[model samples]
Target: MAAERPVPTHEVTNQVPPVVGRDISTSPALLEGLRREGGGWAEDEVRALALLGNSETWQQAGRLANDHPPVLHTHDRYGNRVDEVEYLPQYHDLMRKAVAHGLHGAPWVDPRPGAHVARAAKVVAWGVADAGHLCPISMTYAVVPALRATPELALQYEPLLTNGVYEPALRAPQDKGGLIAGMSMTEKQGGSDVRANTTVAVPAGDGSHRLTGHKWFTSAPMSDLFLTLAQTDAGLSCFLVPRVLPDGTRNAFFLQRLKDKLGNKSNASGEVEYDGATGWLVGEQGRGVATIIEMVNMTRLDCSLMAAGGMRLNVAHALHHATHRSAFGRRLVDQPAMTNVLADLAVDSEAASAVVMRLAGAVDRAMRGDEAERAFRRVALSVTKYQLCKRLAPHTVEALECLGGNGYVEDSGMPRLYREAPLISIWEGSGNVAALDTLRALGREPAAVEAFLAELELAGGADGRYDDALAVLHKELVDLGDPEDLQFRARRVVERMALLLQGSLLIRHGDHAVADAFVASRLAGDRGRDYGTLPSGIDTRAVLARAAVPE
Candidate 1:
């Protein structure tokens, strides 16, 4: 007999709820798969891999996107807003479909059967990419489903969180969603540099503020709700400016014009001119950057996975074409050269998929209230997003070429995938920022780094693959600051530490297809020589091997 499902309390207010982060206790069949087909990878690793493959959370997202058609908000060709009246019904249907799809899937309903929650998240990522809607609706929609560790400051966002913000905005003929949405925040003078943003947010009477600024690349031009980045007395902060007022009214959030883009034709990317528009603050004064980062961090992984899905789809199409389309008598799949290309494509896609799933598992674990797990998961997520998104465009290009002349044609569907792939890397802080984030994480958790190394040592068992890699990485880190060149030493230490932690996990895990994974991180010991850039620090190697368990 099947196990009974757990009852969950539905809270649709300021506090964003997290996806169920329960422990896995079922699925003997899947557990058997891990033991058999996982190719020597650890049990944790196997479980993590399965999370994205069969999660309920992602299934919901996919159903919603597939069900909803694109809704145009701004009538102007260049604007990027969704018409509130026309879009709400579709949005409601989409959210309901997502929720239903999720509930229907297992593991999400019962973690023991498999990693259904993780799989569902992946499905959602893919669906979002396929939908190609420029509306920031997803941005709002995503937060409420599973609030997790986010702050409860935005109680006003409760009504909006229900996927019902469009209702009142659609009540009237000229009603826009909120106030300022789909406005491009980037400028020609400063780019995405928030510190240099010239948008001025001056206080106005009636507890509102006027936003006067010029922004480029307004996505979803018809959005009445504009969330813009501006300079405040404290520094850079985001303001919630509406084209309409709080009492179901319209305000002065104006549009300058829209810009033509290479792709996303169904959507408009425009330059926006806000002529002293009324606005409300999002967080603390001058802390917009931090608030924005919170949103960006959550979504960056989504973007990366989206790009991965597009690449996967593109490659799948090409592989199918090669099998069916004939060039010289036999099919292209029959050609050894074409087959080799497909093999390489498959390998890349599978590897990318594995890493993305693992990262998602980490996020899932973190959301379930594990602090140590959360820190590493966040770091790993950022790195995976950076690496995967960067690889996506190249992978798609290769797949398109494999499809030959047909790939170049618009009707082939390869062009759309190719067009959307690059944005993953460009948006969400780019490659450099991502790399730096990885490096920064190492700086924060030196002990976690040590603990990870110790786990590798245990998994390695003396002179195994894990042992050899761990030793080399450890040696490099130990001797990194000997020359004492400050900046150079700091960089080397970070690089070595990152390599050490990453190599350790890979070695210990060995790419297992999983259901629930926890990378073992033993705390560092109190003894041993200090090896970081800072001299005279406590040595962490011993701590890692004999670190005490937390109470």
Candidate 2:
């Protein structure tokens, strides 16, 4: 080292600076969407969250939490079973921030015009901090609607789930300052088909039921309560299972083992055994799917929001790298090919941001008794969940490639983001499951299809390419007569529907550059399959300007 230092050959150069300090909430696409979707009142609150969410300290917390995954302690030294999950303090910090910002169920409590919209913006804003801890946060937000099926249970636990205080202990629900919730439904035997679940719940003389079954996949195993499913005398039913009973004794919920997963390492998903665990019924005894569908829909919406948010982060990292790093005696951002790729990525990311906030708006209005929005959500959420979640992985891959070898390294942060991108597609439902669900919604409720079409019509006549695409889609729908045929083409139909919806929203609300490029490239088929293939006419500079990294 002394000899090398004597030669004076060491130099550090061309390394891109990490995106830090600046507020990530300043995303033009996300902010425009926040205001457009009825969350304008919470812009200041959203910025306040960004003050910490995007800070250098919290960014380090994200890395540390992921680096040190959660540990499960199945038994104590005294030979007593103590089913507990131990996450790093950094993980809890993220959870605390998320809860304090009303990202969980707090929107349900707030009686404001855009309560859900505000919560959604926080989700997108804070999401850049970390994706793993949000598993429990999302479930906590989702459980409220399903729990409301039983007003007494909702009255008891809703306040705690939405509580801003972050309590990380296992105590009686009433005694805890706040609560997190999870769901246990899928088993090895049945993934999406909860009807095939082998779990059985036997009623005790008391109102609660004793659930005895093995859950193949239980998310956030340490959460205080879970909405699970088991077979009863009547049929499949939903039950609220708590880790600690009302009397303050541990229930029979056991963590068999933590799942060795591909990503979301900071979140503890496990193979849980509900061995005679005490649980209370959630809704009508025989209508388990119907009761839990509300929770499922809420989680579905969060999945899409996370997908959208995740895309924004990937673009941010890639664009930041491009803006700073140099190549072949020039900055990467100035290269025409790199510029095309970055601009294409921004266009797709902006489309996602626009649609997710619109869907969040629909969720807010639907919860507030807007029948039209409810119908639209019944169809739109599923389609969006299918399209956006599926798009994120490939989008992330392209973004990762924009940084070349640097992105491949762990320090670049793109690898973690890339790992997290595919989870949402699998979480609420897999791609096929989501696509089929959209088809089911279209089939069951005529109102759903009508609402979906009415929404697409909002951007009518904005662009000729869009109009032509819409005409082709309409003709295809008219010709789509056979159920078997529709099912066969389900994903394709849904993708087209999603693109058209995105195109329409961009035409009406998104930046002009984004709308024109999206319509031209996506609908008109004037581009290649890979990114950076925009036609010569597209304004790459205008689109990238909206996604530019702040000074």
Candidate 3:
């Protein structure tokens, strides 16, 4: 009646069955091509298509991000500022392009527990691993692109982005580049212990201040900028101190010495001396903890990614060696024990990656304007950052052991994990700091905690598998919201909270291969429970109180 609208020949053939099943496996020739292409292009295509599929949403977000300027500063590898040269328009353009291209989508659209943030973090970590740098540059990419958002101090810091002394810094030579480029952050006392900071930011009447103190470990000694934290009446406040003058010249800060240490050798750690080093206040007084956290959160997530990447590298090395090495008249891979070891390593790396990704996703979501989901995402991020780093290090070490004597050798790259793994657990916030923070966050925001639990329940966690995990965790947690034996129940209660978050994130973002691996990882907890004994009761309150009470 409608002019036989769909009676076309192709349409008529649609009902016919194929001679055999579709068999989508690649042919040998195509497989070779894919292998030759190194899979990156394919992954990019897949990643791109995923983003393109939601173009309308991301496009809108992009517009929003473009309206705001970035926090531009010239920094060395150690987070110190170099100078305030005019901002480079090219970088602004690139950042805008990254936003337009949907670099931000992974942060918000997927709505993972913490996976989004972790994704941005992973990018930064990869840069660190490859270039031995850690600026959390990827975070700006993720934050602006994904959330279409800007930091609160965007106005104050934006001018430095387009016009700052660091403009030439991005173009500086590698070896002779600025001092802070590949340095690490450290204090004579401790790494993330701001309260323990010995550096003093003494104000000079002209709205500038002199920074005096000794920094034990600093990354990117060649960097032009240092995001140094100091004690203020309000509390710990950070400043955007430059290594050079406003006229693009070197300042008084001196690199006192360099630390010859473990695997991050590609990264040069230095002891720095700042004498009357002038710096600009980054934000309001006493807001150092809050403002610098913008960078710290970014750094912590970066550490998680670095750990994951190291684990991935370790697993890859183990697999390659196992498949190639021979032992006792058989290929090492042929041995059941060796096979199990490799399998376990793969599983651990995969699971840890999944947890990190979920945390990253939550960060992405929060950036995208789901304020209600933000608090939960923050809690989830802290937990994942702590758990993944703690859990994956041992896994990596064990995997390296599968390589036997070879793993210990620096040339093998396995030793790097052992050396650098501590960076994750110690920096940003230590494992203990993270664990206690998770508990404290729950206590401070009970509704968010309940919401987080409800989220787990919604994500296929109502069944025995989820409940069993939670039940095991419950025995260790303390319900601060309710006074009933909360003190005795501290660890388990907090653990359950962690499990709930883990399970929820894994279930929600299980689409990716990484996420799928998490479903399998829950078995580890079960095994640990069966074979391992629950430790003696822990008083989280006391532990937290001790940490809170300063010496």
Candidate 4:
């Protein structure tokens, strides 16, 4: 009998190409989006973003996020309670770079015509590299407006907050050159319902209060300060709690345990216990929701921006893989099915970028006292926040599948992105919360709805599909029924409003091919429920070219 022939293993073919070492900021789609959005950042900001895209920076980001998750130090060697969170040096390095790039509070400090747009652009760039560090960056940015409720508090913290310095010490705010802030609003029981918080704040008679409660999720627990919600005699109120008291003593804040999260491992989020921690009231008692909401709105906008950035990165990775990997007889990118999916993903990324930047512009104009823009933002923020964040998870999963098994591995960075995607939806507010907020805004602020519709009308005749979608949305919005009925259909209504707004923005600012494809696939419902299902007639090549990553 002949010996059985043993076959050698075949070489791994059609494997995904390496996606790191590319300049993310200079990617065609991102730059085009930034240019179209009128991001008025100076040369320094542009250079900073480009630097973050370098190979070394990308390597550092990967290393920190994956191998160096934060560690919690609950007690000292001598049995004293230290409650310090220790981070790998890479995390601190990234934080410093982020602060130096003006990502934390640049818009507020600079206050230019398109200040928020500039800041949003930087954040988009940073998010592609690493997202965990942005937790503190975003919280600090959000805290500025809410702190203004108390002039004295704002005056005391503004310089520290605005300074482009990253001081991570758990010292008194007065002693630090800069400060990063965190938020502790959710309790184990309440979740998004801050009104259900069980924390109590007893007056200290000097405009300060002693807070006693626990936070289920306290992000960046080692930060110098936290903006938290607690119950007062009047009602639930916002308070500014520092890690250290004014007399150079440690506050009564205790770290119970760090949360083992799915992603965002580089940042520490923990369960905290406050044993009469000293806190100062930010605004009038009982106006906690209103005051903290100012911060919440800003954070919600960042959430959308981050999701958009993540989508762009996801598409870039997919495009990179397809461009280099060969399947059957041709490059995967050249295959018709792959091209359709890539183009569809590109359209989604570009539309998200356009809408987010437009929202940033609205925020800038509103800050400058543009009532029309402010009204538009009231409705647009919720709409975009709900839709874009919800799009991240499924979009990322589809993008990841483009690389098949390679993407599922930890080294490819795709899994990290997939883990990070759903967080934006859960962060500022979940989908239902955003949908309800949109409905609430429409009902309470008719002017907001009017301004939103007017903005959509700017591109009314550009695409037939868009026009049809807009007509349906308009009818749904205007021919309103009972509040309960509106609430029941809120998600549908918000989704339509988001699609119309995105379509309008793309028509006005995005490439013609990209805009057309978006209208056809998204607004017209000509495609299936997944990515890469674009129709054949659309300019898929143009969309792919625009989305290609810069080497």
Candidate 5:
């Protein structure tokens, strides 16, 4: 008998190629943003990181890191109070790369212009490798600014925080080669209302404080230090609590439990019990919010960038999927409906990049003492953070659906993307918190409003729709019937602000096709809430060319 022919049923056919070997740094929008936003000097390194980010090894590393969530070990073999959290090797690899690239606190130390911009671009490009690991990185990046409020603290620790080395072990801050920081602000009584924290801090007489309280959520438990909030005799205050005391003895930072989160599995968030934890004050007593607010703003910028980067990841995956898979006798990308979907996703992704990069530029300038840029950043960062973060969920959903059944599977990585999308919105602050914060800036901060309007006016006459939207936004800003009503309408107003901001940047500096489509679809209100609802006569081909990988 002739040998049986191999079965064709098991053969894979018409499947999309692996999303590897393609450099995400080659994105037209990102490249343009880098050059336009003063990050051109870092282009070569960005490209190199893109190669590593897209490589098969790092992709698998991301998967493995997520698959094996961190475990909390409250004790050692002899039941000693080690208070350690163990992570997979893959998690450490990602952290190592992130710290080595200066994504944590290097910009604060680097006097070069556009350091923040370059850092933002890196967050956008390499962050696709694994977002969960970057949470600690963001907190570390953020803590630097808050530390500046205390000159001695900033002077002593700034060098260690900005060191481009990653040491995962728990050691004395001085003994460690480098350091990672965390935030222990919230408590069980109050989530975002950090002032309600019950943590108590008393003077230790050696200039440090002894802190004792139950912190509801403390991420990166193994971090060398935490910018925690507690109540002193004065009032609410910020404290730097260390895991290991300088004398080689452990601090009383106990990990009660590791939170089983919805996403960001690679990282650990814990319920911490600080039983007389050693601490040092950051900024003045009774000025905790005033001090930490600076750090929150910086972290919010990263949250915005993370949302933008996540959207780009979604589009890249969706485009790659559609480019290769075929149904109905033609490639999915060739079908009018799917073409509209991919192009629409691309347009939004490009807009996200442009706005985020511009915000980074504002931050870099603001750091250099540009008062106008600082004011613009106040309102712009708040609104951009709100919109981009909340927008990522729907964008991820639409992009995932483009893959049919395959997308729902964990192996495809789309499910992880879907899970990660909602995190940034909920983080920093939830939707209401973010929206109300923007309203607060608009209502309470006159300089912020004036600067934001001035920034909008920069794109005047560039697009009729943008001009019209700006006019409407101006009316809405002033026509508040009541405080409660404004709070109720905050989300609506913030969404418009986000759209106009994106439109303004795209029109001024984005690709012509990308800019035109964004203005007509977003500002003109011809588009539906969902992707793929662009109005007729828009150049889908041209819009997609900027987003799609070259054949």
Candidate 6:
């Protein structure tokens, strides 16, 4: 008998290659978006982003997010209440790198044209690596404007806030070289309704107060200080709560428990009880919502920008895997069906990046005292936040599917990206809340709506599909009917508005192939319900090449 051939058991076939160690900042879509929005970044800022992209440390941060989620320590060995949250060494390493790069407070420290845009781009890049640590970073960035309401407080804290150092010690703000801030605005009863908050703050005779309440969601609870909301004699008010008093003693902040969240696991979010926690009122007593709104608006913009960054990374991973993996004797990316899907994803990512960069530019100009830019920002922020954040999950799911079973495994890193995708939409504000905010913007600031529409009109004649979409949006705005009717259609209006804006941005700034594919598929209804359904005529290969990560 012929000798039976020994079966080879070590063969690994059709395995998708790993996607890492590439410069994320040099992504073609990101570079193009930066250039089109405004090429105002200084050489150092650009170099910083490049370094972040190439750093193995930053890459490790991404791994650490899944491998080492934060843990809460509620008590000491002797049964003393500690209320501490412990993170892995990698988390602190990531935080130190982010702080050293000035991702937290550079824009405010060095005020200049396009400063917010520069800072926002850095946040986007950092978010691609690990988003959880950005909670404190973003709060620190947002708190500056709200702190300005009280000059004394601003003077005492602004330097610490912008010091470009990561001091995680629980001590007095004055003693620390740098500080990170968190926020606790929502309780169990009130999620987005700040007025529904019932936390109480009693006067302490001095310029301070003692807070006694339970915050259902205190994000980054270990921060040096927190900006929280509480009811006072006047009304609901914003207060700056310190973890430690000036005497270097811990405040009466008690951690009840930490939330078991779906994603963003690297950060700690806790249910905290303030048993006479010392706090100082910020702004006026009755205007808590108004004061804290400054912080909320900035965070909302970041929600959109970070979502865009996440989407870009998702597409990059999908394309990289597709190009390297093979089936039926051909690379997956070269296959026509896979090519269409990747091209559609690439278009979505590029358009997202473009719109967010434009929004960041608006924020920059608004900060520079441009009233027109401010007006544009008022409406654009909500619209972009609603649109981009909502797009993240669906786009990420589709991208993951491109990798088949490999993407489903934890080792592939696609599962983590998929898990984190929906968080942006829920955070800052959910979809319905954002939609209503857009409606409120239209009603309160007519010029903001006009500014939004005017920007969309800039690219009207460039594409017939975009022009058609714009016309429909205009008609809906004019014929919005009664308040109830408008409320019922708020999401529809916001979705159309976002698509129109993205279409305009692509037409004006993107390459012809990408712009045409976006308009044809999204605005012209030449696509299906799922991704990778773009029409045959679109330049799928060109779009894929433009968004693919470099070797």
Top candidate by lDDT: 2
If scored against the real structure, what TM-score would every candidate get?
0.64, 0.98, 0.65, 0.95, 0.98, 0.96
Q: What is the lDDT of candidate 3?
A: 0.49
Relative to the unseen true structure, what is the C-alpha lDDT of residue 268 in candidate 5, on a scale of 0 to 100?
95
Model 4: ten consecutive residues of lowest lDDT: 24-33
Give each prediction's root-mean-square deviation over alpha carbons: 15.6, 1.5, 16.7, 3.1, 1.4, 2.6
User: lDDT of all predictions, in order shown?
Assistant: 0.48, 0.91, 0.49, 0.86, 0.90, 0.85
Q: Give the TM-score of candidate 2.
A: 0.98
Worst 10 residues of 6 by lDDT: 35-44
User: Candidate 6 lDDT (Cα, whole model)?
Assistant: 0.85
Residues 1-551 of candidate 4: C-alpha lDDT, one tens digit per residue: 99989987798766665666675544444555555555744435664675565467666665665567888998999999999999888788888988988888877878567777878888887776688988899999989999999889999998899899998877778988999988899999999888999999999888789999999999999989889999998999999999988788999999999999998888889999999999999999999999999899999999998988888888888988889988889998999989988888889999888888889888888888999999999999999999999999999999999988889998788888898889899998899999999988888889999999999999988777888898888788777799898889989999999998999988987889998898988889989878878887999888888888766
Off by over 4 Å in 1: 1-131, 134-138, 141-153, 162-185, 205-207, 224-226, 326-331, 444-551
Candidate 3 stretches greater than 4 Å from native: 1-42, 45-131, 135-186, 328-330, 461-463, 472-478, 481-500, 507-551
Q: What does the lDDT read for residue 445 in candidate 4? A: 89
Model 4 spans > 4 angstroms off: 1-17, 25-29
Better of 2 and 6 by lDDT: 2
- TM-score-wise, the better of 4 and 5 is 5
Question: Which runs of model 6 end up more than 4 angstroms from their true locations?
Answer: 1-8, 36-56
Candidate 4 accuracy as lDDT: 0.86
Model 4 vs truth, CA RMSD? 3.1
